[model samples]
Structure formats: C-alpha cells, structure tokens
Target: MADIEPYENALDAIPGAHPYPRTSRYHDAEIGIHRQADGTEVRYAKRRLLPPIEDRTGDDTQSHTVRTGERPDLLGRRYFGDPGQWWQIADANPVLDPRELTDEPGREIDVPLAGHFPRSPQGDRRG
Candidate 1:
C-alpha cells in the first residue's frame, strides 16, 4: 500500500503563492455533476456569464490589502469585461464580506482573479 499525502490548498501550503490569473471569458461553469456508469464522477459544463472587475486601487487604496467593498461584479467588468462575472471573484475569496464594500485599510489579503471561481452561492458550482 502506498501512503498518500493529504489534500491541501496549493496557495495555503506555499508562501506568497500567486497563481496566474484566468480569463473569465474562458471559464466553463458546472451546471450539474453526476456519477458515470463506471463509478466516475463527471461535471456538466455550461457557458456562464461572468461579472466585471472593479479596481478600487485609488488614492484611498490601502497598502497590500483587499477591501470588502471591492465588488466582484465591478472587478469582472474591469478585468473580464462583465459585471455578471462577480461570482468568479466571490468564489475565490470566501472570507471577504460580500455585503460590505469597504474593509479595514492596510490589511493583507488575497485578491481573486476574474476566473478564480469561488465556491460561494454566487459561483453556483452545484451544476
């Protein structure tokens, strides 16, 4: 028998982990998932509408910090060219306060990419 390593977040295990940003236009969303006849699980992909990117890095921008006010929809539009793509950003950063738009300034945090794909309801990965 072979020992298997426990699964962990790639970014969590490594310091300063920065994955390449993905294009929201190129993301395939799962509409549904099911087990195949061979006992293999498969996901059904659907073309989804992504949100827009809203860069709040202005004079009020905090240093090395991610603000809760940074709307994913806004970001989707700025980065992926659509406001509907906000879910992708939300899915990437679940710790963020979706309701609150602004966070404490000067807090270190992760900035989700256009297609980062968060597991939140907005992302809707159940499909």
Candidate 2:
C-alpha cells in the first residue's frame, strides 16, 4: 500500500495486454472500479448478466443432450461454429461454471440459436 494510483492507470500500465476476445463471455462487459474510504481504487470487470433459463425458450434456443467427454467449447464449435462462444451455453443453463453443463452424460442443456446473444426481453443490458 505504498502507492495509490488512479483506477484507469491499473490496466493502462500493463504493456501489450490483450483485451478479452469476442468469444469471451466478458466481451461486452465494461471495466468498473470501486473506491475505498481510504482512497484505494479497485478495478474489475462488470458482471455479465444472463437472463433466467425460462426466458430462453422457443426459436431462440433448442436443447442438446450432453454426451460423455462433451465440453462447452466443443459444443460451441459444433453449434455456434466458434469454440470460444461456449459462454452462450453456460448462460442458457443454470450453472455458474460452464463445465457443469457437461458434467453428466444424457443431461439436456439449452443451446441458443447460432449468434443468438441473449439480451433481456426488453432489449437492455443492465450489466
């Protein structure tokens, strides 16, 4: 705690740091900061919000039965054609970690239509 710096300077100081990829679940989330009473600033990415599973029904989503050795990235590749978009499947189901989606064989998981980024029905992003 010898030095106190502005929040923006944190990430800016990192040389050649790459931003999150488009396929990342965090692609749309903006950086955020929290200021402490003592003047320290903590920077972080805002939480990426996902709607409840019930809202994803119909044309926007379908179902897939998880198989042995199946993984979210592989599922993303097969369905969305981009292995990095696995977060889409994570959001569609009720799991904090995408790995849980494929934890059991024969488990049914939600698969959104390709490129169907789930936004609130009202078309707003609160995150």
How do the predictions measure up, each by TM-score? 0.31, 0.67
Q: State the lDDT of candidate 1 residue by residue for 23-64, as single tens digits.
A: 333333434678989999876544454333232323322223
* CA lDDT for candidate 2: 0.72
N/CA/C clash count, model 2: 0
Per-model C-alpha lDDT, please? 0.43, 0.72
Best by lDDT: 2
TM-score of 1: 0.31
> Listing every candidate in turn, what is its Cα RMSD in Å to the true structure after a full C-alpha superposition?
14.1, 9.8
TM-score between model 2 and native: 0.67
lDDT per residue for candidate 2 within 77-120, as digits (tens), equals 99878888787888888887789999999999888886564663
Q: Where does candidate 1 stray beyond 4 Å?
A: 1-64, 67-69, 113-127
